[model samples]
Target: MKLTNKHFRIAEIMAAFFTGSQTEQDERDFEEWAKESDRHKAFVNRLLNPEEYEENRRALDKFQVEEAWSKMDKRIGDTKVRKLSSWRSVVRYAAVVLVLLSAGVYYWWNGEEVREEVPVLYQIAAGTTGARLTLGDGSVVDVLKDRAVELKEVDGTRIVTDSIGIDYSTRETVDTAEIMNTVQTLTGMEYMLTLSDGTKVFLNAETKLKFPTKFQKEERVVVLEGEAYFEVSKDVAHPFIVKTNGVEVKVLGTSFNLRSYSDENSIATTLVSGKVAMFAGENSEEIVPGEQAVYMKETGKMDVKPVDVTLYTAWHTGKFIFRNETLEEMMSYLARWYGVEYRFIDEGAKKLQIGARLDRYNNMNPIIEMLKKTGLVNITQVDNMLYISSTE
Candidate 1:
């Protein structure tokens, strides 16, 4: 049968169902369609049984069998048939079959070669929620997932930690002395923090933030060393200031994203709401909503320009939105979040610009596949390192 848009839609629904992301309506529609023909029911059964599917796939031509085995060995290891406990494993298994079926169906109907060849990518899990909290006394506490702990500072400030995040709003007593604390997230980790003044900070991977357990009466100051999105509590009396490197971001009540990684050549502060003033040396600029203040470390000059704030703030919301970004820049972001390293074999490929909006919470295979579909670069992974080269 000739493949049409309807077939593609059905394939999408089937894929969603297998991945356990299908909605109730989609499940109902799929069931209704499956009941129309025994062949459809058989296809669904085959998808449900991974062992049978693997057996049939191995019976294909020599090249297909070898490729399938290679991918399976690299991704799933030596175990050919085993019970999968997570939807992620199911996605891995079903994704291969779905891609092959879709391609084969199109080729059989249209008699055309597949338009693109997708490389088999090794699974690299996405970042998780975790961080290290260093108390004022230089004692360190590991903040992990699904564990609850209550910590009391020497000044009687109560800090609560849970699976969601760390909260510092609760206090047993107020003190004039501000006890400084720090939270650091390594690669493959992101975390959220609620300050004593109700300001919520979302920290990205390989980032560090140092703040006092209690803000001083005059000002709320925090030191950031990497990237963070700040929703400053509306406190007109005490202005909130974020100090990073040689620059300082001053705001009373505003939301913005600041990126001041030591490795990056420039520091970017994108205003999402309210107003923020970026100050570096003698240079100062007050950026309004939808504007970005980029400070070049080399020249000590600050430039303000309008930008799509979502592009910079999307990571706080668990998505990566890149537009016309170089391959080197994009890979740097991915490397930190995925806890993986990448090397460009073709140095010229570093300058290739690409745009993509991907979920930061999904497995890295889909993201790699999307990059491969761009057709400008080729990616291959060995262990945890990804090698990128130009397709040309």
Candidate 2:
């Protein structure tokens, strides 16, 4: 029988299901369709069986998976994008590769629990939700935990600390002198800061933001060392610029997220709303909402593309989201937030894709337990280091 577009779509859904990335509703739909007729069952069986669809598989060269994914992403839309929970699902056939890789099969998604067995592990301490404030004079103050203590006045800018966030609003524009202040968070900690110019920033764990206590008349520039989400206050006269390792993001009255981790390969600047211009070396690109600018560290080349802004900004909402992300990619975030070391026993395991969502503030024990439950990779802890290996 000649396969149509509908058959290809069903095959895609089947790949998602076997990889444990499909949603409960998707599973129900597939099951319902499977029970409808023997033809449907045979169709699904043909998809599941590698030999049946071998001739139909499209030839994809190295890195062509990303292109296929882009087409599939356009077809599926961002709403259905899910995080994989396991890496056990493997694709050996070329036809399955078209389905698997197009859906970002490196990230495994296990919708339901495969078994009731829980791995043996000690409860690890959760990350702290606190940050340290460095004044212009180089004095460090623990603001989150010690909110009651009176902080030293910085150029008459009152820094107020509440449970929700840290506010640095000036009653009057007293000092135009640029005195830089920094806020830093360690592993497993996050912070929210309101700048003197009313610009709000959310700093992620192991992140740092350095900004002026007072903004200059022409421009508002800040140096960032880690990941942060910015809500820039409208100042048409002054452009807000965030400078990181290889890129600079310029905005005016906009909200966006920038991630430039040292361990990561690229620096990603994701725009949530409004507009922003990203500059890397001589290259510059303007991106609007739902767009991201990725600056490759090695080549110093910047590429802008549309993205799901929510996934990039999920950290600000106290969540960690991985959509078609690899184990190495996910572990980099985990290592920073949990302050742990990761060693891969199998190199192939590092390339395994995973999709899942978990509370960022949760203890490492539960997170490790969930990964173990997927039965894709074995996670063992020795001191602060986590050893990950393919179960197969």
Candidate 3:
């Protein structure tokens, strides 16, 4: 059977189900469906749990997502998201973010059903359950996970991370207290930070960055952890510098990737555009787009390679594209985005590898079916831990 747009629409409906804050009619429909047969209930459960979907034999369990979304809605609260002036100029940007946020993206198809096997690594990930944030000045912003935000006037920088696009607005700073600051977020999350000099940054999960809200004269600098992507603004006088996990990247006006995950044994900096010379005590050189600077956290050695930029930025988009990415690397992305802990009980999980592109925003089982269709691995779940057994 073939996967059709109906499944896509149903998946979107389930996305709304997982995250409360649904519309009036939607709630009524959910109630009606709940009163229906047990099979209907089982199908929804299958949709919620990717692991259950892969087996095709697991029975339904009470949905936990109802409680998860309820907690998320309360955490987000009545705080309003600041609107970006730039978004006003964008073409039809309002529909995408606003519509999807309140009611999940939807597309209905009146067609036949298709039930197909998924690829082993092909699985659906649940939406972010929500996260807590600690600000530099002890302030806290409890952001509902998966929700987009546009925050401006932070020490004079226009810092925003939205679906329209990651935009860094140029700002003028007049104070010194805002100079040295920190931006921190919890696990299973990511953010975009636009600096005063119009440099754009994307911060990954469980990341902490100590940066100046405003740049000092002649140099723009910051310290990083976890991962981030920077689109540096052009400034001949003030050079942008990023220090992370013992590696420093210096770029005048360029785009690059910085990985400083403390748990991982390596810090990687990939250049997507422009040029930059890295400084790591005597062993470093300049790099440009398609080149990655990987520093081993354990051995303290650097290796540079040319890579496909799409693989690095795919998460920024809705799809995870893998042109031969490793099994652990792929699972890590899913873990962060899905807000699930990767407890690999199977030591042989490393032997499993796959190459595919998955739009995780949709259904997980359909993706699982797609993965199994690849015929590379078998999957099982027990006690909320996913065990991936490699076939090859």
Measured by TM-score, the strongest candidate is: 1
Instruction: Report lDDT (Cα) of residue 114, candidate 2.
Output: 17
Give model 2's TM-score versus the native structure. Answer: 0.67
Per-residue lDDT over 119-183 for candidate 1, one digit per residue giving the tens place of the 0 to 100 score: 34459999999999999899999998787989999877788999888999988775557799999
Model 2 lDDT, residue 29, Cα: 73
Report the number of the highest-lDDT candidate.
Answer: 1
lDDT of each: 0.78, 0.70, 0.56
* Candidate 3 per-residue lDDT over residues 62-99, each given as its tens digit: 21223223323343332321222222322122222211
Worst 10 residues of 2 by lDDT: 107-116
Look at candidate 1 and give me any clashing residue pairs: none
Model 1 CA lDDT for position 256: 95
TM-score of 3: 0.60
What's the TM-score of each model vs. the native? 0.70, 0.67, 0.60
Candidate 3 Cα errors over 4 Å, as ranges: 1-125, 128-133, 144-173, 343-346
Error of 1 at 153 (Å): 0.4
lDDT of 2 by residue, 252-327 (tens): 9999999998877899989988999999889999998999989999888888899989889998887889988999
State each model's C-alpha RMSD to the native.
Answer: 16.7, 17.1, 18.7
